[model samples]
Target: MVFTLEQHDSSKYRRKARMISIAMAGQLVIFGMLFSMLLTSTFGNSLWFYALGIVLGLLATSALFAVLRERPWMAEMRYVWQLRQHLSQISGFLPTLRGAVEEDNRAALDIVTFYHAGVAQLATLNGRTPPEDAAWLAEAKYLAEKREALGLPARVERFDSQDLQAFKRS
Candidate 1:
């Protein structure tokens, strides 16, 4: 699915994310205690049992986080999180994307446009603006022109997340 931009409260989102993270940490601690007791009762308090209980607690907490993260209250936080993840994923393969662009690969060009657009969207969402002459802005402009030269749109605001995988093949 393509992602669309929606304004959000950066401070509120950060606060909510921090609160959720703290809650998850508390869940882990409580589970750790409970698991430790249960395992001690069943396994005679061995040191290995304590370690295993912690591992189990971590798994449980992770599962709980996955479920909670899908709830409606997490919408803003989730969107920002997903955007951050998409940005991170592309960064790892950027050299590849740039390389493909050098070859005039249309798909690469589209992906790059999407990438820069995504960055700009995130920055705007976070209530910050880059200077006109910033390196990122200049680079984004250059890429947009390349896309425009090929009779394509200057920038893409919505694109499929799966398009990121194209870099892997590059």
Candidate 2:
């Protein structure tokens, strides 16, 4: 998938995330309480019964929400979930990406560029510093400079996940 450079309003996304969180928390609590009451017959009013009921309820709600999140109302939540996954996958290949850079691999360069830009955007939205190593920060800075020095165009707005095929771990 290609990453877009559109600016996201943090408050808007935060509200969306809060709504989904509230829904899930409500489900967890409601299910937990109802199941705990119902399971008293099979397991009695013991800690084990309470524990088992809560676990089952949690499993049920988790599964339910996993499917529910696909609906249009959950767009913000889904986008955030996907963005985090992309960041993690990109991070896992940092070493290989850095190495690939020396070889002038365009795909690796694109992935790295997307990673830096995306994290910075996320950081802005979350009101925090971008979580990255000094080495990575230096590498990102150096890459931009070198690219500009060579008059190569920046491709920060769009990055394809398929480009990550080159960095798969054995």
**Cα RMSD to native, each candidate?**
3.4, 2.5
C-alpha lDDT values of all predictions: 0.79, 0.79
Least well predicted 10-residue stretch by lDDT in candidate 2: 146-155
- On TM-score, the leading prediction is 2
lDDT of 2 by residue, 69-104 (tens): 889877766666777788898898988997987787
The TM-score that candidate 1 achieves is 0.75
**How well is each residue in 56-76 modelled by candidate 1, as lDDT tens digits?**
999999998888888999998
Q: TM-scores for all candidates?
A: 0.75, 0.84
The residue pairs in collision within model 1 are none
Model 2, residue 100: C-alpha shift (Å): 1.4
Per-residue error at 64 for model 2, in Å?
A: 2.7
| Clash pairs, model 2 backbone | none
Clashes of each: 0, 0
